[model samples]
Target: MRADRLVSLVLLLRRRGRLSATTLARELEVSTRTVLRDIEALSAAGVPVYAERGRHGGFELLPGFRTELTGLNHDEALALLVAGSRRGAQVFGLGSALASAMLKVVDALPESYRDTAAGAVERLLIDPETDLLSRRLDAEDLPDTIVGEVRRAVFAGHKLRIHYEAVGQAPKWRTVDPIGLVTVREQGYLLAARSGADRTYRLSRILAAEELAEPAQRPDRVDLGRAWQERSVQFRTGGDPVTVVVRVNPNRREELVGTAVALLAEEADADGWLRLTVTFQDSRHAEWALWQLSTNAEALSPQGLRAGLRDRATAIASRYATP
Candidate 1:
């Protein structure tokens, strides 16, 4: 472990010259005393590392000391730099690792492209937490301790006990065989098996995790992408859904379509509107979506839906009626 830390220390110093011991300690997640000892070790190993004695002074390598192990070309280095700037690395609790790796990637670039690559990342924004309508996207907060345990369990092939709070359900502790962790649209999910049935748990909902020493009952090799696809298909098709036919203004068709679970059919109306048969998660969902669109969208089928809408509109109309 110290060996890896020493190597990271060297890489940090090599990439970012003249780093203060305090800065090194913060970046390395250690103390200044440890940083001083590491510097002494590097110097003893003939690394030509030296310290300066004043306010603006810090540890820096002597001139002309360089490692020839870098091999990334311009475009390759730029791609890595850009990817390293994304939210996935931080969302998965690998922000520090990604930062260190990007430093190496930038340092590996040719001198002519290094600054350009670094500057190019500044112009790109990936996975902002809010949309154009100012709605907060799903960027759930995952505790570092819980995530670390889940990650360990997934990697070590160990059974994990987690305190999970499913939506609308009380928190409960579950013992699961961790298959893998998946991230979609910035949310993290742990794909595991519970009682030999496929289970998916949102990482944010995991209040705590304990990695058991007993090996998990899972195959040695897993295709997480395929597994995720299968789980997604099951989720999309399993719910008790309600189908509704709706006639919507041509301009607001997309708004109505966005809320449906599935689009069954669509046609152009004689009045230049769009008639569509779509499915929603349930009647409540169906009523709410059309209600939101007001006059722009009309639910044409499923008599229950139209009645529900009629009752709601009548109530609203009575409340605001001319008196």
Candidate 2:
């Protein structure tokens, strides 16, 4: 572990040119004394590290000294830099770690490829808070302490006690064996088993979490992709779903089908539109999704949904007419 810390310290100095022991201590998450010891170790090992005295001076590497870490090609370096630019890791409380790792990755690249890769990354913007439609993409609000506890339980194979607040339900405490943590669409989830029955909890909804001393009751090896897919299928089908039959333009069929949980049946109409029977999470979901298409989509069955759309349209028309 000290070796790893020494390597990190060298990379930090190599990238930053010079940094104070206080800065190195903070960056390495170690005390200044540890940093001093590591610096001495590096010097005694024939590394070209030298110290400076007084304010605005600390440690610097001798000029032209480079680590033998030039393995990344141009595209590979670009990929890592671009990935580091995204805020997805913030949800998992790994943002700072990702940043530090990225710094090491960039510093490890061959000098010839470094500036070009960094410049290319600067030209691209990813996951900006606001998009062209003025719609904002905000990070999830997950307490770092809660995420850290759940993460530890999942990694250490320990059972966990969590206070969860499911939608339309009171907050209650549950002990579960955590299978894994997942982030989808900027939302975090914990896939676990309670009494050997699979369950999922959103990290944002976890009011509190405690790692238990007992070992978790889970398989030694887990295929996260398979587990997530299985749970997703169960969640979609198990909910109280609302079915709708609609006639939509052929061009918009994919959009309609995408918004629905499943497409039960499809028929092509003479007017170049599609007759689709679909299932949604609920009536409100069906109405809201279809409403986005305006008149391009029409509810054929479920008179209640059609009436609801009509009422909404009437309200809109009345407001415009009044002007």
Q: Could you estimate the TM-score for every candidate? A: 0.71, 0.73
Report backbone clashes per prediction: 0, 0
Best by lDDT: 2
Count: clashes, candidate 1? 0
lDDT of 2 by residue, 16-117 (tens): 888999999999999999999999999999999999888889999999998774456788789889999877788888888999999999888888998999
Off by over 4 Å in 2: 1-70, 315-323
In model 1, what are the clashing residue pairs, if there are any? Answer: none
| Candidate 1 lDDT over residue span 240-290, tens digit each | 789999999999989888878789999999999999999988888899999
User: CA lDDT of each candidate?
Assistant: 0.88, 0.90
